[model samples]
Target: MLILHRRVQLLQMTLVDCTREKFSKYEQLLNDAGQKPEFWDVVVITARDDSQKSIFDYQISLKKQRHEVPSFVKYIVISDPPGVKVGSGGSTLHCLEYLANNFGQHSLSQWKVLIIHAGGFSQRFPSQSVLGKVFLTLPCSKYPIQMLEALLMMYISIPGKMNYGVFIAASDVIFLFNEKGNWDFRVPGFVAIAHPASLKLAKNHGVFILEDMISPWGKYRSDPSSPAMVATPKCFLHKQTAEVLKHKDSYLPTVPI
Candidate 1:
């Protein structure tokens, strides 16, 4: 088992008030720890053309901090070809495919993939952002398509132990914490429901499971505050789950996701 000192981090919700100062501090926090690349890795992507020079510089500063950031904790950026509508979800899918194909699933040790959009900032974008949410909202997505796809992929990918923390950030910047006395990014429940609980169910069909764990045939919906999202099998997914992901264009897009 792998373990590291957990940092209390902050999760950004919007681009508004997105001054360099606000997040710049977090970079220092990650760097002070002298993070080795093998300790953590992140794959961040952009759907539209945005000035990521700032974000890049921010990460580079942190990555270079031998005292805090690990020389081994490598980060990369990917782009979808122009004209191809690779939204948030698609971007994430594409990143995963690219990572798996080039580096193989085992490339990064304990990896984390953040599928954020250039235009879209975060969940708080529409409500609090200075500009409109540029994230491509899928026709079917009351939520954003990229966001849904990201969550879906994360839902499936996380069951197994990952190299980098495998995640799909629809349009949010990742920050390493110093000691804010807040959220712990190490725990999976921040985004996923715990597995092997009693509510576990096995059903059938190409069902769009409404709960945390996928049910075969049933469609479930839940209250925002309720917990029993879905029942999950203990341990990780077997090779069978990987076979399921290989179908159609399940992997990340070479051009986009």
Candidate 2:
């Protein structure tokens, strides 16, 4: 058991937000994170809205600037429309599913993936002087990191005790890799849920779930403030949740940490 435990490795992932039409700017985040030829392969997950051809073009341009081919960079395009397009959490979930199915394959299960949302910043173009202010200005609870945690915990079940983590930041956020900060995959569990102080300020500290008051997949009722507005597990965890738990009596509840 001890030998097997020692052999166990978690997945280190970085789920860059590529929902935007332009991806050229996203490379800077990777560069700042100390991306190098020695670094492991990076999978750039894109939504259905993103075209592989366009992404390749962006990568080519970036490579010219960097003066080297980003051999470590890989792209995985998701068929689901991103939250900005169709439904909330749809795009992020698709990315998670991609990791779970593909990374969970044989031999690969031993690795830990660290997910970093390149688009976690509030603004794409932030000045150097205001970078510090931007980092401190964003609310932790509202930070996309919360959504990342809730989504991963609610979904993605690993076979072994293998764990996962995310590196979230608001604009002006910088991730430095050194003696203290390394790409090593740690144990499975909540490594860190962003700045802990932010949780204390949340108005509703509990999980925010969608309630489906209307039944039989019908249209909205005349009254807008129906039970569907607040009663969840009864409504659905997500649109995808509605598909599986359509038994009318079935309830799919999600627990957020």
Candidate 3:
């Protein structure tokens, strides 16, 4: 699920305006200096407790080779201390504490944050085990770009309007959408993007049960100018069996085979 915070109270600026100003300043700097400035205020990459050094080494290699690694952006690697295996959630908490202690809460509150959870050794794709999955080269890209670069490109437009709130994302999956399309991020509370998938596919991922079974795709296709349809989720089930989904009253058929 993709969740976006509406605003940050400390900044006292609308997310959209804050985001725009950030990009505007970056663009001006890039044009003047002929090099990219720090695009993100703080980029925290969570790593496994033992793999912290390896991740740091990988970044150094990328910079030495002059790849697409954005060295300009301030990146901090946070891992579980000592014997504790805090997992993703714990690592994030450790990051917050580190920031508060080092940068102070007041200063940290004003900065835009991007947290990437990419700590696991890619056992399924063992070739990426050393460098991790985030550095895996994509075959579909026109030019050579690693998974990290591709993820950054996908979110390049989102930060401009965002306030001091954090943007958290996983490194494994990529969501494709129209870059120029109108996307509303001003909605209050957590906003998750949903995509249509077959029942078999849904079993392996999270499925949202909406209030109604009516399909909104018909209206969306018929009138492109209309506002995007929003649904009220009644419940969300993760990795549920096909039989369980079929029995749910609000469960609607997904994409057909």
Return the top candidate by lDDT: 3
Candidate numbers, best lDDT first, in rank order: 3, 1, 2
**Candidate 3's residue-wise lDDT over 83-134, tens digit each?**
7577766777787788889889875558877777777767798887767777
Q: Mind giving the per-residue lDDT tens digits that candidate 2 earns over 1-257?
A: 56433322110111221112112332333344464422223333332344532543454455446533234444333444435554324445555666668776431343333333323223444542222222122233222222222222221222122332332222233321111112232444333221111222332232222344234223212221111221223232223334343344333322111
Displacement of residue 224 (Cα, Å) in model 3 is 9.1
- For model 1, residues 1-257, the per-residue Cα lDDT tens digits are 12111110112222212323333443444455454322225545453433443444454464366333334445565655456566665766676787878888775343565444554434565552422232223343233333222222223223233434565444432222112222234545534432221111211112122223334112222111122333433333323333353342222222110
TM-score of each: 0.36, 0.33, 0.71
Question: What lDDT, from 0 to 1, does candidate 3 have?
Answer: 0.63
Q: Candidate 3: misplaced stretches above 4 Å?
A: 1-39, 57-61, 64-67, 81-84, 107-109, 212-217, 220-230, 254-257
Write down the TM-score for model 3.
0.71
TM-score of 1: 0.36
Deviation of model 2 at 35, angstroms: 15
The candidate with the higher TM-score, 1 or 2, is: 1
lDDT of 3 at 149: 66
Off by over 4 Å in 1: 1-39, 50-72, 108-110, 119-165, 172-257
